[model samples]
Target: MASSFHQFLLLLCCSVWYLTHISQSQSSPLPNALLLPITKDATTLQYVTKILHGTPLVPVNLVVNLGGPLLWTDCSSRFASSSSRSIPSRSIKCSREKAHDLGTKRTTCPSSAQPCEVSTENGITRMATRGELVEDIVAVGSIAGSKATVDQFVFSCAPTFLLNGLASGAKGMMGLGRTPIALPSQISTALGTQQKFTICLSSSDGILVSDQGPHDSVFGPEISRSVTYTPLFSLQEHSIGVKSIKINGNRLSLNASLLSSNGGTKLSTIVPYTTMESTIYATFIKAYIQAAASMNMTRVASVAPFGLCFSSKGIDSKQLSLKVPAIDLVLQSEMVKWRILGRNSMVRVNDEVMCLGFLDGGLNPMTSIVLGGYQLEDIVLQFDLGTSMLGFSPSLLMWERSCSDFKFDSWPKYSL
Candidate 1:
């Protein structure tokens, strides 16, 4: 089953690469980069974004999914747009062939004369419906300055049932996956920009910029000096080559094959934290505890999701961040590690307790390490489709700033 899941994941990502970006863009509506503000739910720790969609421009809250297939929203809302209209299935031919690849439940129109129907699924609950392929307006302020309104912005119109397990007030899911089905590729097709975007996430709210250049001010000195770029594994559930694990600069004794990105590790926004298989999780905990003993990090009763819990008593911490041992995810080489600091490595359960941000993914899970959103907070990630590289900056908090520092009310001079 695990092997099959890996095969399926690889297939999903592989399909994205061969498809053309501008298969559907008849004309350019908005030429500049698109900006979407992201917000994290306090309860779920999941990130969401708000967009002004439809004719009258009602605010639509959508969960940002790294591996989701397409942008889809609940059309059952009372504010369903006046200008929204369903289109024919043959016009764009988007996802028509890949519907079989999904292997999920779907609904389709019985006759060719009827409008196109789509199966919009909830990435969280997996609820699906034969939603309509509708076109409406999407208005947003661009990084190129001034607000722009996109006409005939196409998306799937799902029923209210697909909204289950979403963040409060969220009615849709905005897919940022690697394929043309995602926002970057869709915008690239329409606006003739690079099929790339940078997403900087804070604990609560973050920023998304499509086809944007680097902003040294927004990312600080670390972006130019310490940014690490890794070749992305084509999987929609994106994975990267993790050569080894290091705790406080000490390499852990582990099999190289176990840490392979081929099937062992993947990234996810849905999972609450970076998760490891039971055996690997045990080894990691042992190493962390051994390294932390000198710092007086006393082990306490394990938290429900987290295995390693330490008492906050006598420990130095400010707002759950401490100068703890750094957990490094060594990338292509020993020198190219993605250093995870205290703020990204540990979570404050309470004033009395703190826990490791990683979880255990059972004994024989499909993927060994599923990197989650908690570790991704306050970090800027640039997904470049042209180069097929994932550029990540060192934690923003390292420079005393967070992803929350970005001002979205207007455009800034982001250098190319």
Candidate 2:
């Protein structure tokens, strides 16, 4: 019976040792491939292949040659960098909180006959102006003539960088034969990876002779009336495990499959946004410019030459011939709906409604239009004659388009 008890005790001790070894193996991090080579150099340190699963392991202490057990620590614990990133930047003034804070007295505003003097220099002084003040407001309207057309092209990244490194590929065609558009990097960065983007053409798709050379280089058959946008790069969203790509003005989230490339996983996915007709219009502005010029030749009632004065001071008046481009814009037939939201006491129209008004030609030489008594919810005004306009909301005069319906025949041209 004593001999049996001794054998049981010995077995129990062996079992305890085995269990303790197994528990330690489960708790400890996996060692590096070369850590236990059994012939490691005395001065070499063992490096782990993977990070431990729990909180960062406490840094081991090392001794200095001149000191007795000099202390060393991993700064990764106390001074580790964080993932949070924020930058102060100028964003669109869309928030109402910012607008209301700009305190301007109501009584000091303009009356009917006399234009109000606004505080210009320091908000203490004022400058009197004619008519009323205008504010920036956006609305959907039909475009006609050359303005209705747009050109779309995927510019090579090389040309894009040469013109302006900061500008996205959208503005690649701008300033081809003209002074280059001075695009700073800030503008490009502000357009954070756009899923898509749109660029407005300042020129038409036609041949013209300037001091430089032939303008025909910018025109092509592939140029369509719809807006053009190109995708550049992509990023992976950690939360969704999905990849996203930036095109001109849109973003496309996509699911991707990982495949092995060079023995490593290569993540690949399809682009979200595709070039479609309904989403884009490809046309040149020159087509409309020619149409408008042709209409002007037939519709002009009288031709008049007048002397334009440079200034009220020393400059002499120069004789200039001006042709007024007039069109019998179908008022009832060509009307677009204008919806405006009012504030304080400015609401004029309710909800969305049709605004049946003709766009008349303005006296400006370049291009201008006059809208007669057209009322939207946020905008209402009567016009006499001038370029600057005002709105009922914030009292500031602004130079804005008076016409909407833009028509186009074909795609416009552009150069890079």
Candidate 3:
């Protein structure tokens, strides 16, 4: 009888130990990659993410910008006074050395000036100015999960004009470029990880809740194996080399010399906010039109800004029998080809009209190929600062399943 009781007790103890081990493993910190659900406004292609800033933690929605080097938000009187959780911007002196290091011309400041004025250009044509720089606490990730908070975090308090123009509805912008003042640098230091981060923007329609990962972050270790990496050129610009571009299977006769950044030509791979040079855009449109023509597709009258438009009066974008040619952006190597699908390359302007998304960047004189955000929608972009490499893969959410049916726990199985 005593032996039977001892055996039962041992079995119970072993079961408890197994359960405890499983729980501890489940609670472990997530890998280096942090995945967040990016929210795109219905009217615009810009992607926004949420972050808590300041002492009491005011939730600020910021645009995830890859082309700028400064993290800033609107600090106007209205924004400061409205929220009880809002932390007022404090005054700080701007030194000549500091301005130079920030990649801007040194401005003359008087000794009596409490808030130093500094201005920097954004990814687009907008110029934002900060009247003062202040230190505050910033919390990243979710409040319920493994969150990182940095005390005495420094950022800009932009002028009313800049705030109103650039980030009107949103709080401000979160710059992801390779600058000392960028958000990635600050977050890397706070997390004690290498200065690295990845972005997996889902193009899936509808609202997406945070995934059920252990750390409650995006792009964790489970998805790492699926990423294909390419070397990143120009740290500040985050440009990658493009060997050639092919429409369908035929390659265009492009002048490689004109594409180079040599001499006075400012041509380079830029993740522009919007628009591309007329010359570059024209070439792509011509080839795309040719491909569509071959497919016996009829083109309707051109819209004002869009060079190409198709009548979708009878059929929806998904049901249209149009065979839009696949655009292959051959990167530094022939093996690395980034394919832009028809759904992404074409924009649905209205219920009856679908237009080419590429715009003429004739306004800007500099010869450049700007890869707008629309081209990158629904793609997972991984920026590795430590190795100066950019990795990308199609989002797993591209399957036929609805967004609500996505299971985060089974993400690894769907990785391409």
Clashes of each: 1, 39, 3
Task: State the lDDT of candidate 2 residue by residue for 1-416, as single tens digits.
Answer: 99999999999999999999866654432221001000111122111111111112212111111000110112222222232111111223212111222233455533344422111111001111111111211111111112111111101111112222111211111111000111111112232321111111111111111111111122111222111211111111000111222122122222222111111111110000111111010111122234334534222221121111011121111210112111211111222111111111111121221111122122221111111111111121111011111112111111121111111233122111
lDDT of 1 by residue, 205-271 (tens): 6888775444443444445466789987755656788888999878888878877733756767777
Name the candidate that leads on lDDT: 1
lDDT of each residue in 267-317, candidate 3, tens digit only: 121232335556666887898889877865668888777878876554445
Instruction: Give the range where candidate 2 is weakest over 10 consecutive residues by summed lDDT.
Output: 32-41
The lDDT per prediction is: 0.74, 0.18, 0.57
Candidate 3 has which clashing residue pairs, if any? 34-218, 35-217, 35-218
**Residue 35 of model 1, lDDT score:** 75
- Give model 3 RMSD, 1 decimal: 7.3
Tell me the lDDT of model 3 at 103. Answer: 46
**What does the lDDT come to for candidate 1?**
0.74
